[model samples]
Target: MMLANVGTADRIIRIIIGLAIIAWSISAENLWWILGAVVLATGVFKFCGLYKVLGISTQGSTSK
Candidate 1:
């Protein structure tokens, strides 16, 4: 299983931004929703592939 690299605050922000983008996409009929979905997935999963690749972790050491 992949470790969580996203912190709580980061997750919350991503979720909010993702939802907003998705909402806008639904209203605008654009493809930006795909990006939103990706962002949402990262937030929901609490793991970011890019963060993994970059060796970054916003999660606190207590969780690890």
Candidate 2:
């Protein structure tokens, strides 16, 4: 698959955020699974709904 540049950045950011959330959740007795789901969805789809709704596109239409 010719994954877009946005995809890469999205995946990386999602994972980082997910890890942070999970860490905080673990320390605060919260749900880590929520963050896991967000990370999974973003990583699998390579598209972030929040990013889309905000009209943010990190990559060109074509993957380089």
Candidate 3:
């Protein structure tokens, strides 16, 4: 199963930041676009491999 480690607010912020990075990358025609794409993807999917590696999850638990 794909665990959703990103919360709604975090995802929204990521998407905004990612889009800004992408816009800058496009204007500069640099490799930063790749980073932006990855951020956007992680936001969209609500899963972050880095978060997994770091044992960090923004999602609230439902263990009740």
Candidate 4:
């Protein structure tokens, strides 16, 4: 299994923000759903590819 670098709090916030953005984008007929998808993916999976590339992790040691 792959390690999850995203912390619980961060994941929650991401999901909330992603949903909000997606809702707003849909109402405005924009393509921001792509961004929402990325955010949701990272939060759901508890992993962030950009975080890994930048060597940044929010997860605690025990979680890793």
Candidate 5:
């Protein structure tokens, strides 16, 4: 299983951005929704594969 690399703030921002992208994509009839779904998944799961690979973690010591 992947570790939690996304912090609270990052998660919130990702969720909002993901939703916006998804909504816009639907209206525009584009394929950006796929990217939006990935962003949303990372936020909802609190884990980021890229962050892990890049040795980046937004999570604070106080968080789980």
Candidate 6:
């Protein structure tokens, strides 16, 4: 399975960031919700583009 670890801290941070973005969108009427959307998307995919660029995989073995 390619879907591996994605530790607890990262998961929580992603969720918090996404919620914050969405919240900011409502309160500040900014486009920061896109950040939230990205966070949510990353959580769903269990993959981060930045992480890949940095050659990092917290999700255990990326090789399926």
Go through the candidates in order and give the C-alpha RMSD of each one to the true structure. 1.2, 3.9, 1.3, 1.7, 1.6, 3.2
Sort all candidates by TM-score, best to worst. 1, 5, 3, 4, 6, 2
TM-score of each: 0.94, 0.55, 0.91, 0.90, 0.93, 0.71
| Model 6 ranges off by over 4 Å | 1-5, 61-64
lDDT of 1 by residue, 1-64 (tens): 9988999999999999999999999999999999999999999999999999999999989732
**How do the residues 17-49 of candidate 5 rate in per-residue lDDT, one tens digit apiece?**
999999999999999999999999999999999
In terms of lDDT, the best-performing candidate is 1
The per-candidate count of clashes, in order, stands at 0, 0, 0, 0, 0, 1
The better candidate by TM-score, 1 or 4, is 1
Give the better candidate number (2 or 3) by lDDT. Answer: 3
Each model's lDDT comes to 0.96, 0.69, 0.93, 0.91, 0.95, 0.74
Off by over 4 Å in 5: 62-64
Which TM-score value belongs to model 3? 0.91
Which ranking of candidates, highest lDDT first? 1, 5, 3, 4, 6, 2
lDDT of 6 by residue, 2-59 (tens): 4434555787788788887889897998888888899977776677778776777776
Residue 5 displacement in candidate 1 (angstroms): 0.6
Error of 6 at 27 (Å): 1.6
**Residue 47 local lDDT, model 5:** 96
- Which tens-of-lDDT digit does each residue in 1-64 have in candidate 4? 6689999999999999888888988999999988998898899999999999899999978822
Q: Which candidate comes out best when scored by TM-score?
A: 1
